[model samples]
Target: MKLLSPKLLLLPMLCWVQQAAAQQTTEALSDVQKIEYASPGVRGMGKPRGIVVEYERLPQFDIDSKSDDPEIGNGSARVRRHNKFSVRALAPIMNKPQTKLILGIDHSFEEFNFENVTPATYSLYNSLEDKNLKSVGLQLAFLHSPNEVNFYLVRAKAELNGDYTRDNINISDYLKTTIDVAYGWKRSPDFAWGIGFQLGYTFGRQRVYPGILYNRTFNDKWGVESIFPANARLRLNVSEKTLLYTGYRIEGASYNLLASNPPLSKFNDIELRRTDFKGLVRLEQEIYDFLWFAVEGGFRQYYRHRVFDDVGSRDYIIKNDLAGAGYIGVEIFAVPPRRFTEGRKNK
Candidate 1:
């Protein structure tokens, strides 16, 4: 009986060791897959989204613009609606154990509807309401890992953003370029972190900023994913098929408008600068294998929404501080198949 007692005590310890080994194996597999398939939005935080369609809308808000020059009009207007829709696709062109290359393309359309202009003197309002702003972007990214723990990523994206009008049709005038570079340490399957720098125009003007990436899985039910100054979210795993996130995101862009629009013709190329800050709650649910649906809603605030002729001269035409409003967004996205995420593990 004494000998049997020792054996019984060891049984639980052996089972615990086996469970730990299994969890480590699963986490290591996730890391291996991330090396091959880095996500487009937040690098290796979560599953790579292959195809995505999204829409966002804002409610009514009051906005008034002031200009130094009276010809451009100092006026107040009520914005009835603001809507945006976007589509994105990502594909891995080259995949290897130590290196990966991905290609992505995205397109967006934005519309603004205005009513009740106090002084119907601004001609630009007609152009703004009638013409939808559009953006087409092309991105290429490369990831390399010299060994199992350390990796670096480089990405470049080019965007053509503007209202499609005969006067604003010049491609060169509408092009905007951005670049991102980072160095990461995949310390374990459950955690990763990195630091980098970004050259982009998320503030409605071209600026350089530091970037930080942190991805941590605390347990099966809770985690965090963040890329600072862009987005940060607290993740909740409600179930295998459902996830919830609460976080904030920064969104902004520069768009080219009609050079022929009135008083601005004396200036150089016309550009509209816009930025939004939002604190949101997002819910993602799997409808079936590989297909998912996401819905998010939040309050939107304007950081800066203005018009400028040439940033070099620093002459601003119209400056606006619109009232805050609630906004909602929905998405339909697809993830990789079992063959890409599962079968590779056995091999």
Candidate 2:
């Protein structure tokens, strides 16, 4: 199968599963029943209810030099160390017996550096580095559950991303968007599975990437959490207030470029495509009911990093080797308040 074929095939399955599972949930809950609280210490979207800030220290990494463009004249490939930061806020906008709504915003910032550039290409490389990389996005999500065992999810986001160095920034040209829809089934108190596809435009192309979301606990001590083609983790419960995880994830983004300096300015605006695979180990500790801290370190393996001209032609490649890095972050969240119907008690 091709890179995106599986994702296309899974779209239909998502809808089918949503309807079937919801039917089962409705039948199972035919009689009036009280609410059931989720298992303690379950890490999920529902667990983090308010604000999150994450920062990672990216270490220097060696790059495998290969570019079709001869003007670059590269001797060696290396990416200078940099810092990455992101802040996210999520809040419940609406809550009802069978439907829910959430609104969120995620913003990120990073700077880029390419090491060991030949003097001949100095002006070009400097122009690229002078541009600051940033992305800001707003997210709207909806959830529908016929009963406790099954639910449907729909999330949409619009993002503004680019190197903000231009005098006349065309905000419309830099906009990026994504949509994800899925159905989930909770087979047991400790196990759940979901199927869905995330559709978006990246690297100057449109793609439909399908994935499976899953969470399963083998026992009190071991478990797995994963969304295939994106991330997967094996988790260990250390204590009531602590947890450990080892996992790998696929990460990447496409940024609009501004080649404003002389000589390189002839190339016009470019598109920088970056993708990486990371294997990591992380520790999470709770400080209080509303606060938590985490630290993680891992290897970053560059999978794809390339530059494309405005006409959608490949211009350069930034092949990089494996590098080690660390990250520390904090989160402040609220315990979700119980929902009540307008005219009747929740039961």
Candidate that would win on lDDT: 1
Question: Which residue pairs clash in candidate 1?
Answer: none
What TM-score, computed on C-alpha atoms, does each candidate reach? 0.85, 0.78
User: What would the per-residue lDDT of candidate 2 be over residues 173-227, giving only the tens digit for each residue?
Assistant: 6777777777777666667787777876422344677778777778878888777
TM-score for model 2? 0.78
RMSD of 1: 13.0
Per-candidate count of clashing residue pairs (backbone under 3 Å): 0, 0
Give candidate 1's TM-score.
0.85
Q: Over the full model, what C-alpha lDDT does candidate 1 score relative to the true structure?
A: 0.67
